[model samples]
Target: MMKRIPIALYFLLAGLCAAAQPKKLDIVFIGNSITQGGGLQHPLEEAPPVKAWEWLKRAMPGSNIQYSNQGVSGSTTVDFLPATNKLFNNVVKAADAFKADKDATLVFSMVLGTNDSAIEGPNGSPVSPEQYRLNVKAILDQLLSSYPGCIIILHHPTWYSPNTHNGARYLAEGLARLQSYFPVLDAIVAGYRSTHPGQVYTGYTGGFSYFKKHPELFIQENGRSGVFQLHPNAKGAAELGVFWAQAIKKVVGRLK
Candidate 1:
């Protein structure tokens, strides 16, 4: 029995050494109000404090991770394109500190294009479907060029409430429904994946199909018909944040 003590101690020490190595992870989330956290069914409901990245961090305890929420409410893809914001300098330099750490695995998630289709107020103007594609491509090309090894995931935009009375779906071009342009995202990302192969992927969050079946989960406010539902309330956020995190975890797992 005494002789076996040394052998057991050796194995225990090895396990400790292996467990001491920390995994490095970095994530960046980009989009508009939906991505940032907005839209509630009730006028009295408060915003959900936890977002997708925060929920993800909570999910994985004792892991080395760096994350940032770059979501800007009421902003369109044009805000991210050239002649607008300095995505690399602002996003990478300001928000993404992990970019400095060469050893860290980087993941970028984009949930945009909703505001691009807005027709309300002075700022609202729907972008042409083709232009939207080009803007997205520009965003990707810049990111990949900066971090050649980074992993990219395109999140499908959330579904708009069918109730047209609220007028949030007001269109700047085309037949009027702003959500129709969403499918262009799939096409653009699909082409991106084909050329980039394993480095890029599309994380289908089922936003459109989901809310359609479970409209109760969405916030319905404004207008007698109650048509404003481009955002999810606290309950919606929790469900969505969790679902998206699952997709993110899958991609993060492939980092090694």
Candidate 2:
């Protein structure tokens, strides 16, 4: 009787350990030029998504992680809307590519709104806060419907100089408008608790506040207004990736 009891306990422990093992991650990054690693010398290697994947590799050693960077230059929430059939379709394609890995859990990480707040550039310039909320919701709705088991993480857009005016014009007013979207994003994620449950979450919201305090992280550029900072330098991109990886790690942990 004692030998039989030991065998049963061993099997139970083994099952628990197997269940505790981490699942492979298949992440699809969706956003704008910042996410595309715009103006970087080696965007493919130095991009935030790549850096985030690197971070996860180190943190979880031996875990399988795959990512696709689908960020488009000058894209907006409006451009990614379901009806547009442009950027949104690309995202769907990217997600579909990972469907073959049945053992992998899918995740979508998004960062946008920099161009949307612009006074004059991007597909949807000067997007009202209300409109931005609706646009984001619509995108999330489609994503959730399509990838029912996947997780979606909405990252608030980072900081840009108030006088930023190169191809687009995001002055002080634009910055204010950009800040307004923060709360809206939070509300959207919170609302999903009742609607989508644990499928949707907010990720890495410290970029704006952190970059505001540390301007050196940004790549200083000459805009129409004067010298301005919008994109992140290599170091900044690495740090931003860490932010995302940490957030993702937490979300992944919850799954276990």
* Candidate 1, position 2, lDDT: 58
lDDT of model number 2:
0.89
Q: What are the per-residue Cα lDDT tens digits for candidate 1 across 1-256?
A: 4555588899898666445433666778777777667664431223322355566677556557666767666767777774465443556663347767877778887777667765553133467777778888888888887788887888877666545334445422422444565677767767876677666777755877786677676667675355556567677877776667777776665554
Q: Model 2 segments beyond 4 Å from truth?
A: 1-21
Q: Please give the CA lDDT of all the candidate structures.
A: 0.66, 0.89
TM-score of 1: 0.75
TM-score of each: 0.75, 0.91
Residue 123 lDDT in candidate 2: 87
The candidate that achieves the highest lDDT relative to the unseen native structure: 2
- Model 2 agreement with the true structure over 45-121: per-residue lDDT tens digits: 98899899999888876578899999899999999999988899999999999988888989999998999999988
lDDT of 1: 0.66
Model 1 regions more than 4 Å off: 1-22, 39-49, 58-62, 86-89, 120-124, 164-183, 223-227
Q: How many backbone clashes does candidate 2 have?
A: 0
